[model samples]
Target: MARPSLREKIIESGVRTLHERGYAGAGVREITSDAGVPQGCFTNHFRSKEAFAATILDRYHERTQAIMDGTLRDKGRPPVERLRAYFDAITERLEAAGWRYGCLVGNMSLEVPEQSEVLRTHLVEVCRALTDAFAEAVRAGQDAGEIRGDLDAGDVATFLLAAWEGAMMRMKVDRSPQPIEQFKRVIFASILAPGVKAGSPQ
Candidate 1:
């Protein structure tokens, strides 16, 4: 195997650091040191910490997008099952990390939006992409009669993202997967439950 380039090292380290520590909590010095590079190396590659954060955020989103592509976009599985599988995969990752670090996108959404307009804009775009992925699956589910048809797919996607982020926040606070499990339970049982159409008692 080949050694990672200096920029790659910094980005790999920055992704882990930023995920573990919020934007304000992660420092340039820490990121460089974690990468085993001098502080100057960060400035050499990235114009600013905010710029570096944007890079790492994109890297993080790419990982998530891969997961979505594999599961949410997998046509072989049932539409609703694909949604469950996606969350299940995410839960496994959270468990692997000991539930210490939640989603980077969700973490940054809470921390950096007010601090950096650059990051805020980037986050908005990232969120839109994520919502679109979910919306695609929701629309498929609706078409398959496995999701409520009356509800707008985009609206459901937006709500799922927001609610999942909130559940992750609660998971971090509780240091348990209960919150996440509850999210899946309620979401599957009521919100995304099959045949539960509009005006029907849920």
Candidate 2:
């Protein structure tokens, strides 16, 4: 029941502020105001805006990873189903946010390069961790005959991440969830389809 410190408050509110406004739009003053702390406190706690954003990215990654772990690592559920559940959960999150904010890592990957390399490195870590989890899940599905194994799991995971991130960008551009839904439909039906093994032409 203890209160969050000023630094913690910035990171907590900074995550939402950055997600909503992006790197260029999210000002330190705005974040501090959202956190209910003075703007001057930001410099006292963090060296610069880039350093603050790195902390926010780490927090965001931990949160999304927890969600992924809950659905993807549930041994009782089939691996493919678990994959669907993970996307379903993400869809709900995007819908709840009125489709305004996409994944923090994806947002930063697009918006932050002009700002700082340090933060970009943090973004890369978030992306790699997500791909690793997806790859493991895909491998599990292949083992259980729930997903095709003709394609390398790592390659498939990389493709899925790339496609999904691109679709998320599309969603933001069009301000519609249609792109994400289409991605889910085609990806599940073709790539992750059960017992799908590519063979020679008949």
The top-ranked prediction according to lDDT is: 1
How many clashes show up per model? 0, 0
Q: Which residue pairs show backbone clashes in model 2?
A: none
lDDT of 2 by residue, 57-111 (tens): 8898899889888888777778887788888899999999887788888888988
| RMSD (CA, angstroms), candidate 2 | 3.9
RMSD of each: 3.4, 3.9
Write down the lDDT of every candidate, Cα atoms only.
Answer: 0.89, 0.85
Q: Which stretches of candidate 1 lie above 4 Å from their native place?
A: 193-202
- Per-prediction TM-score to the true structure, in the order listed: 0.94, 0.93
